[model samples]
Each structure stands twice: as structure tokens, then as C-alpha cells.
Target: MKIAVLKESGGEPRVAAIPETVKKFVGLGASVVIEAGAGQGAAISDADFEAAGASLASRADALTGADFILGINGPEPASLAGARSGTRLVAALDPFRRRSDIEAYSAAGLEALAMEWMPRITRAQSMDILSSQSNLAGYKAVVDGASLYGRAFPMMMTAAGTVSPARVFVMGVGVAGLQAIATAKRLGAQVSATDVRSATKEQIQSLGAKPIFVENAAGIEGEGQGGYAGETSEEYRRAQAELVSGHLAKQDIVVTTALIPGKPAPRLISDQQIASMRPGSVIVDLAASAGGNVEGTVDGQTVERHGVKIVGASNLAATLASDASALFARNLFNFLSAYWDKEQGGPVLPDEDEIVKAIRVTHGGRIVSERLAA
Candidate 1:
């Protein structure tokens, strides 16, 4: 089987297949082709890939006759224009919001697998791109917030006076949120967190951070499939807002990472909440790309309002290109390895496989995901 790794476009600074992964694909008896300059964003040169036994080719050359194509993001429309039927494409395509891209891929007679849909089962953990990327984003969010804050994170003592540690409030308890809490605590900040899932209270406490509970979540099921948080009712939103309002006033740094799959980020902070915060406080909104969790946040920009700095950093993982690309490329490699058929010397798409069923978005010139079809 011929596997092609294309250079990422759309200003994305990460490559799908790194040199280390190219070596693995070649070990599987597959001919690996990488587009020229594909790994530039990750600080990898074409020479590196060539040394790993991958031939460098132009974008058109790489896609023209390849059996499978890999990318970090969705391929450009023009690149997919000449793809042949039965070609398999894999990427961390955000199909929930980019359904049109999936339709376009299907129309182009290409089979597409979205890495975001990888099941959260133990066996599939290595292939979980969301968790891998989110972990970096969470750590970066804390680092970025600390840089923007005028005061120090850890307490200090001097002949002049004693300085208290900054107070940090994390508004989600997922992989990213938990990382944020741990990072903040390690930086000597007083960290506290809240979540829609009641079970996260123990997780927060285990990290030496206090858990702020939303009292109204008692009868609500906030845990969704694949270990994601589900959407809450209007009543629950009101109670959550009431609980968070009091805590906002005292926080020096607030990092919001709440998200519901296939839905806009639930707004946790309003203008009034921002207005109530003390001057010089910082808020990092990780969900800003899919509609912000904080009101008045603009994706990819930081804005100050009512004396508080609100950072809406989109794609925080991309900021750490080398490490993020390595992790993401490993995820793709693991998924490919799991589905590889040794005797056939290629990937096997078994429809009955739970992991395949969860991630296979399109096949045989049609949208195949039951969730997307619905």
C-alpha cells in the first residue's frame, strides 16, 4: 500500500506524519511518500524524512496515486480534486462543525476517517488525538495566563513584605482542565476547579485543589459518551452561573476549558462577571474557537474589558508545534497499526470493529457515520 503524507495548509503549524512515524509506516511494508516541506512547521526538513526512507514528492505527485493520505488538518479543496476512488484519507477533521468537508470528501470518492471520533475505550487510548492535544493546550493555557498576569504565581517573602500566591480557578475538569490545575499548583498558585460532572470533585481534591460544585447538578447526567461532558438544561445553567459568580471576584487567573461535543461552548462568564473581576486578573478561554465560554472573548485574540484581560487563544496545541506534532503523529501511527492487516500488508477496514465504526466518517462514496447520517 502507498501511504502519502501531505504538507498541512490553512496556517496550521503541525504536520500529520513526522519522520519517526514515516519509519514505522515503511516497516509495515508500505511505501511512504511525504510532500516536500511537509514537516517544516515541526522544524523537520525534507532531508530528515528522506533519511527515514520516505521519498519526498510534490503535493500533486503525493496525492495522485496514493492508496492512503494522511494530514494534520483537512486537505485543501484543490488537493482533493484529483483523488481517485477508494482512496483513504485520515485527519483530525472536526467533522462535527465541518460536515461540508466530509461531504466533499465523499463526493470526491475518498474514504475519510476523523481522528476526533476515536472511541475512549482502553484499547484505543493511544489513538485518542483529542486527549493528546488537549493535554498540551491545558498546560500552555496556564503558562500563557501566568505570562500575562502582572503579579507572580508563587508567594514570596522579602524584607519589605510577604507576597501571597495567586488564586487560580479552573472551570473544567477534563484532561486539559486537570492539567491546568496541576500546572497551576506546581507553579505555587492556589488552584480550585468546577465541573458539571460531580465525579470530578474527587479528582480536583486528589490534585490538592479545592472543588467548586454546582449544586443543581444533583439529578443531571453531565457525563456523555466517550467520556465527554453533555449539554445541561437551562435550569442547570442558571444554578451554575449563580455558583460561579461569587467565585469570580476572588480569582487572579481563570482558565475555562468546558466543551460539549457537536455543540457551542456553554457560556460560563458574562459581562457582569468580567465587570466584577479585580483589575489585572487574567482569563484564558480554551473553548474560544467554538464560541467562547467567556463573554466578549474573540477567537485568536486577547482583549481587555472592565480591567480584566480575556485571552481567547485558539489552537493552543499548535503553539507548541514540535511536541504537539510528535504526539499527534504517534496517535495516527497507533491507529494505523491497530487496523493494519499483516497478511494483507495494508490497513483493514472491518465494519464490525468498534473503533473503526466510531471513526469512519465516509467510505465507498458515501457518509457512513451513523451519528453524522442522523
Candidate 2:
């Protein structure tokens, strides 16, 4: 079996497969070919892949006779011109907004597996790209916000006056939010967090951050399918907004990490509330790519409003390309290895398997994912 690792386009720095994963695939009796310079963005070289038993070739040459294709992002259909029909294209295929791409994959008779749609079940934890990438993004959000803030994170006292610690507020207590809270606290900042799920109150406290929850508020039970935050009622939103409006005014740094699966990110901060914060305060919106939690955020750019900086931290994990690539590649490897069939000489995805059911987006020349079908 042949596996092709394609270099990412559109300025994405992370690569899907690393030398470690290429070596693992080789051990599984698969011949691995990497497109030339595929890992350059992650500081890896062709020599490194060659040492791991992977051949470097051009994109067209790499796709020739390939049975499986690996990528950090889904390749444009036009780029897969050389690949044969029924080739399994594995990646974090953003199936929702990229519906046309999914259809194109179906038309091309390729089997598309969306790694991002991996289920939240314990068995699939190691294969979860979202959790792995979001963890890094969360850490970066806090560090980036701290850098943009004019004052120091920790309190300082010397012969002169004392400088108080920065106050950090985190919205959404998911993987990213929790990490952001922990990072801010480690930096000696006083941190607080809020989430639609009341269960996260203890999680926030465990991370040494205060929980800002609305008491006795109805419709705050936002535990969605697949462990994502569900939408709340209008009544609950108003109550939470009032509470957040007051808390946000005093925060020096804010990191918003709330995201609903296949939906636009919830707006956690308003322009009016942003104006209340002191000058030079920083806000990092991790959901900036999903239309932002802050009003003035522009994905991939940092903008200032009312003298406060709003960083549109879209794909913050990509900034740490080396580590992110390693973790992502491992996730892909774990997934394939789990389904590897020694007799078949390649991974076998059973139709009824829970994981296969969850991630298989296109198979048999049709868009088959129930998540998208629904």
C-alpha cells in the first residue's frame, strides 16, 4: 500500500505527517512518499523524512498510485488530478463550510475521512485532532495576550510603587479555555472563567481560577452532543450577558474559546463592554475564524478599538508548527494503527464501527456522513 503526504497550501504552517509517523507507517508495511518540502513550514527537512524511510517527490509524483493521502487540510480537488479513484483522503476536512469540497470529493470517487469529526468517546481520545490542537492554541492565546498587554502579568514590588497582577477572564471552559486559565494563573495573573455548563465550575476552581457563573439561571445547561457547548435560551443569554458586562470591565486580558460544532461562535464580548475596559487591555479571540466573539476582530489580524487590542487568533496552534505537527501526526497515526489489518497490509475501516461512522465523510462516491447529512 502506498501513502502520500501532501504539502499544505494557503499559508498553513503545520504538516499532516512527520518523520515519526512516516517511520511508523513504513513499519506497518506501507510505502510512504512525501511531497518535496512538505515539512519545511514545521522546520523539518527532506533529509529527515528520507532518514525515516520516506521518499520525497513532487506532488504529482507523490500522488501517483497512492492508496491513501494525508494532509493537514483537505487538498483542492484540482490538486488531486493524479490520484486514482477510491483513494482514501485522510485529513481534518472541514465538511460544513466546505460542503462543495465534500461534494467534489464524492464526485472524484475518493474516500474522505475527516479527522476533526472523530468522536469524543474514550477509545478515540488519542485520535482527536481538535483536542490536541486546541490545547496548544489555548496556551498560545494567553501568551499572545500577555505580550500585547502594556503591563506585566505578575505583580511587582520594588523600592518604587507596587504593580498589581493583571486580571484575566476566560470565556468558555472547554479544553482551550481551561488551558488559557491555567496559563494565566501560572503567569501570576488573577484569573476567572465562565461557561454555559455549570459542571465547569469545579474545573475552573481546580485550575486555580474563579468561576463566574449565573446562579439559578434557567437554560444554562449547554452540554451539547459530542461534548460541545450547546446553544442556550434567550433568557439565559440576557442574564449571562449582564453578569459578563460587569466582569469584563475590570479584566486586563480576556481569552474567548467558546465554539459550537458546525455553528458560528457565540458572541461573548460586545463592543460596549470592550469600551469599558482600561486602555491597553488585550483580548484574544480564539474563535475569530468562526466570526469572532469580539466585535472588531479580523481573522489573522490584530485590531484595536477604544484603545484596547483585539487579537483575532485564528488557528493559534499553527504558530507552534513543529510541536503541533508532531502531535497532529501522532493523532493520525494512532487512528490508522488502531484499524490496521496485518493480513490486508493496510488499515480496514469497517462500515459499522463507531469511529468509521463518525468520521467517514465520503465513501462509494457519495457524501455519507450523517453529521453533514443531518
Candidate 3:
């Protein structure tokens, strides 16, 4: 089997395959071909992949007669012109926003699988790219917020005076938010978190952070399908907003990580709330890529509003390219290895498999995912 690893476009620093993973695939009797400079952004050299038994070639040369194509992001269809029909392309394809690209992939007869859509089942944990990446993003969010904040994270009692610790409020209690809470607490900040799903209150407390929850609010059970937070009623939103407004005024640093799968991120903070916060306070919005939980987020840019600094961190994991690449490469390896057909010398994804159903976006010259069909 020939596996082709393509370079990501659009300034994406993370690569899909690392040297360690390349070596593993070689052990599985697959010939790996990587595009030249494919791993450069992640500090991986062509020599590194070569040492692991992979050949480095130009993009078109690498794609020629390849059975499987791996990437961090979906490659443009035009860039994949040389690949033969039935070449399976796997990546975080972002099918919702990139519908036109999905169509192009279908027209090209490439089977497209979106790794981000992997289900939250117990068996798929190691294969989950979203969870692995978000864990890093959460830690980065707290660290970034602390760097931007004027006050110290921990209390310091010097001879002159005692500097109180900064107060950090996390709006969302998913993997990212939990990590932010833990990171803030480790930095000795007074950390607190809130989530629409009340079950996460215990999770917040377990991480040594306080949970701020609105009681007696209808539609508070926001736990959605697939372990994601679902949409809530307007009544719950109003109540939560009122509670968070009071809390925001006292926070020195805030990190927002609220997101609904296949929907816009829930707005957790408003302009008025920002105005209420003290000057020099910082907020890191992890949901900036999905329209943000804060009002004035600019996707990848930091913007200031009402004397508060807002860091719109779209892809924080990309900033830690080396480790992120390692983890992401492992995710792909774990997924393919699980379904490997030793005799065929390749992975054979059964059409009826639950995982196949969830992540497969385009197959057999058409859109196939039920989520997309819906």
C-alpha cells in the first residue's frame, strides 16, 4: 500500500504525519511518500521522514498512484489533480463551511473523511483529533490570558505589600475549558467555570476550580447528542447572562470555550459585560473560529474593547506545532491501524461501521454522510 502525506496550505503549521508515525506505517508494510517540506512547519525535516523509511517528493509525484492521502486540512481539489480515482483522503475537512470543496472532492472521486467529526465513543478516544488538539488549546488559552493580564496569577507577599492572585473565569466546561481551569489553578489564579450542562459542575470542582451555575433555570439541561452541549432556551440564556455579567466584572482573566457541533458558538459575553470588567483585564476566546463567545472577537487577531483585551485564538493548537503534529499524526495512525486489512495491505473501512458512518463525508462519487444530508 502507498500512503501519501500532503502538505497543508493556508499557513497551517501542523502536519498530519510525523517521523514516528511514518516509521510505524513502514512497519505495517506500507510505502509512505511525503511532499517536500511537508513537515517543515512542525520543525520536522525531510531527512527525519527519510530516516523513518519514507520518501520525500513533490506534491504531484507523491500523489501519483497513492492509495491513501493524509493531511491536516483538506487540500484544494485542483492541487489534488494527479491523484487517481478512489484515493481516500482523510483530514479535518470542515465540511459545513466548505460545502463547495466537498462537492469538488466528490467530483474528483476521492473518498473524504473528516476526523473532527469522529464520535465521542470510548473506543475512538485515541483516534479523536478534536479532543487531543483542544487539550493543548485549553492550556494555551490560560497561559496567553495570564501573559496579557496586568496582575499576577499567584499571590505574592513581599516586604512592601501583598499582590493578590488574578481571578480567572472560564465560560464553558468542555475539554478545552476544563484544561483552562486546571491551568489557571496551577498558575495559582482563583479559577471558576460555568457550563450549560450542570453535570460539569462536579468536573469543575474536581479540577480545583469553583463552578458558577444558575439554578432554577429552564433548559439548563444543555447536554446535547454526541457529548456536546446542545442549544438552550432563551430563558436559560437570559438567566445565565445575568449571572455571568456579575461574575465578569470581578474577573481579571476570562477564557471562553463554548461551542455547539455544526452550529455557531454560543455567545457567552456581551459588549455591556465587557464594559463592566476592569481595565487591563484579558479574555481569550477559544471559540473565535466559530464566531466567538465574546462580542468583538476578530478570529485570529487580538482586539481591545471597553479597556479589556480580547484574544481571538482561532487555532491555538497550531501554535504548539511540534507536539500538536505528533498527537495528530498518532490519531490518524490509530484510526487506520484499527481497520487495517493485513492481506489487502491497506485499511478497509466497512460501510456499516458506526465510525465510518460518522466521519465519511463523500464516498463513491457523491456526498454520503447523514449529517451533511440533513
TM-scores, all candidates, are 0.97, 0.98, 0.99
lDDT of each: 0.91, 0.93, 0.93
Segments of candidate 3 deviating more than 4 angstroms: 219-222
Q: How much does candidate 3 score in TM-score?
A: 0.99
RMSD to native, candidate 3: 0.9
Candidate 1 per-residue lDDT over residues 253-364, each given as its tens digit = 9999988888899888999999999999999999999999999999999999999999997999999999999999999999998879999999897989999999899998
Candidate 1: C-alpha lDDT: 0.91
**What is candidate 3's lDDT per residue for 82-154, written digit by digit as tens?**
9998999999999999999999999999999999999999999999999999999999999888888867899
Model 2 C-alpha lDDT per residue in residues 238-302, reported as the tens digit of each score: 99999999999999999999888889889989999999999999999999999898898899999
Cα RMSD of all models vs. native, in order, equals 1.3, 1.0, 0.9
The local lDDT score (0 to 100) that residue 38 gets in candidate 3 is 93
Q: How high is the lDDT of residue 177 in model 1?
A: 97
